[model samples]
Target: MTYVAVALLLGLVILVHELGHFLAAKAVGLPVVRFSLGLGPVLWSRTWGGTRCCLSAVPFGGYVLLALAGEKDYLAAPLWRRIAFSLAGPVANLLFALCCYAAVYAVSPGEHSLAGYCVKPLAWTLGTAQAMLAAIPRLFGHAQELSSLVGIVAEGGRFVGASASRLLMLGGYISVSLAVFNLLPLPPLDGGKIVCDILVRCRAGLARYYVPVSACGWLALIALMLYATIQDVCRYLA
Candidate 1:
């Protein structure tokens, strides 16, 4: 049950982001050849007005493939329109996070609003969400807990309950975080695109290497961090 909730939450936010892209592309006369939810092969799809929108097999994330969005077609379009399309995805994510925060806040105890770091998720969220779901098994007379305490992480603790003001604050913080994460100046990612754009206009020699170098560098750092974490885990377990 806990896993299901987590997946659904992630899927919904991602889908809304894709929808934002789709809508913006259509509005700007940029054909969206394929708008897909999830990562792999199609589970289900429907074509409308020269667009093929699909739900894919992967549950991780979704994409809106704006037709020729990276090519001359997009470049030929009005600059404002192109910028709007680029911004739509993250805007949708913020809105989705807000809606989720509002619903959760309304159902809980104190004051709540969509102004803060709701989606950032601290370490306690998993366990809290898990424990809450485990209690539901009682309706079926099951004695075992459905989800167990995982670990403590930032943005997950003390997030549950009745405060609307705090909930909204969390939501806003997470939305800003998502925006900033995408804005990061790096390749195969949104931030990378911006850097590439700059390199193109400035005739920089590093244009081709911008994405690859940053990506590889980050990957190496992340791998080292993971290795260190595994060593720590093994030590603790031993």
Candidate 2:
């Protein structure tokens, strides 16, 4: 039951992201006709102040539809407001992460010592020398262990220093990760849009070359992922 509650609470963080979009769009006098939590078909809905807010059938993602936001006229509004609307979702995620961290630190408070290996700042270092003294080989480069699942197994059962703090750190890691991923200067993504904006304002000719280069870079990344996945599967089967 508590696990379910944790999931539901996490859902609120995502909802807050959509709310940020709704609020920013409304602030700029944009027509926000549909606000939906999750994707696909609507589960339930309400119309308020000319906005049709609904809960959708899918649960993993959500959106606030600033009416005509994707169309040409959406650009009729002020440029600053448009940028603010584009930025709101990720800003909301950072705020939600702070709240999550607060909840975690409230439970199982720990010290910055070796005993913290069972407590926390599990590998805290007072200075450079201490950090060097405590350095240990990691499976994934300074990564820390976090949650425990009831029916899951880990490589070599190596959860020697797992704790709530580590788990919360992982949550923050994922949130920041998304922000970083979204900010990458690639096309078909927020970062790409920003890059396009800059390139248009700066060099008109080089922007022509950016698109093909972006496509090739994406293809390379996909190939790398496929190679890594195949290696992982082979290793697991072995």
Candidate 2 backbone collisions, by pair: 186-192
Per-prediction TM-score to the true structure, in the order listed? 0.59, 0.57
32-139 per-residue lDDT for model 2 (tens digits): 989999889999999999999888886746777777834335444555676677667767655555544554555655633434343322122122123322342342
lDDT of 1 by residue, 82-173 (tens): 66777777676656555655455556667555443354233224333444345444834642221211211112235523455554444444
Off by over 4 Å in 1: 108-177, 198-238
Q: For model 1, what is the error of residue 193's alpha carbon versus the real structure, in angstroms, after optimal superposition? A: 2.0
TM value for model 2: 0.57
Candidate 2 deviant stretches above 4 angstroms: 1-10, 110-170, 197-238
lDDT of each: 0.57, 0.55
